[model samples]
Target: MPFLTAAVVLVGALGLVNLLLTLGLTRRMRQYGHLLDGLEPAERGASTRPVGSDVSPFTATAVDGTVVGLDWFREPTLVGFFSPGCSACKDVLPGFVAAAATKRALAVVEKGPEPADEYVEPLAKVATVLVDDQAHEAITAFAVRAFPAVCAVDSQGVITETGVQVARPSAAVPA
Candidate 1:
């Protein structure tokens, strides 16, 4: 009878230890989720180049080998930085394309080993689509660290708005 009592106590202790480990793992997972949420651009802490900063001068060849330079920003330009694999970039692409209706938007798509014809095609219709295969010069010039980011650049070359995604200007705001 004493041996039986001791065995029962040992089993209960093991079960308590298991419950404590599970609770700890659950708490850690919740903390990790919060960390991920904070990394999202919509979160206040997401990093971006400062507004009102001038784009660094850069020259890059477009997919068609057309030379593009700082002159691209001489007009009020809406520049989008995207990656082929980023789901967030794909989600915001149609809005980016529609905003390009004024002929003032440009998309710099980070090239990968796989062909991105489908993603590039739609933007090509309304915007100058630049496939960045080599150095990612444009991405460096704009200080873009995240995919699906947009900067509203003024005619004078100053960035007016910078965010994770382009906000189509309200009709009241100048196009």
Candidate 2:
């Protein structure tokens, strides 16, 4: 009887420790999630990305190697982060390309040397695309947690909206 009671007490104490540990982990995760992912641009990046603040300003290059900066009151820009390494990016490329015909659309391939011919060649038809030299700038700048994500920014470089799994999106622009 004494041994059984001791065992029971030990089990109960172990369970309590586990419960406490779980709670502590949850709290830490909530508080430190940003450390793992990045800052909050507030839904400014992909849908999977964490959205914070209404807007974020960033500078990106064009396929033609022109530097494009998000302005406050100019025209709207649609930024798309894509990778040939990702299957979803390939799937969404068509819609993104189509949208570029009517609006400003960009795809980040990789920065430095131009992207592979296979990816950039097809995207060139529609997008004002560029390559991301920084592998995770989009994720950090906009908290884009998901891939094949899109963000819309106004002329002033204010991020208006973002979609995680959207094929086509509508954004209001000033005439």
Assess every candidate by TM-score: 0.69, 0.57
lDDT string, candidate 2, 1-175, tens digits: 9999999999999999999999999998999877868664652434533323444445655668666544422677676767666777778777776666677666666432334566678777766656555434444555555667776766655666667433554432222
Report the poorest 10 consecutive residues by lDDT, candidate 1. Answer: 39-48
Error of 1 at 27 (Å): 17
| Clash totals, every prediction | 0, 18
The candidate maximizing TM-score is: 1
Report the C-alpha lDDT of model 1 over 97-144, residue by residue, as the tens digit. Answer: 777776477778888555667667887777777785522887888887
Report the backbone clash tally of model 2: 18
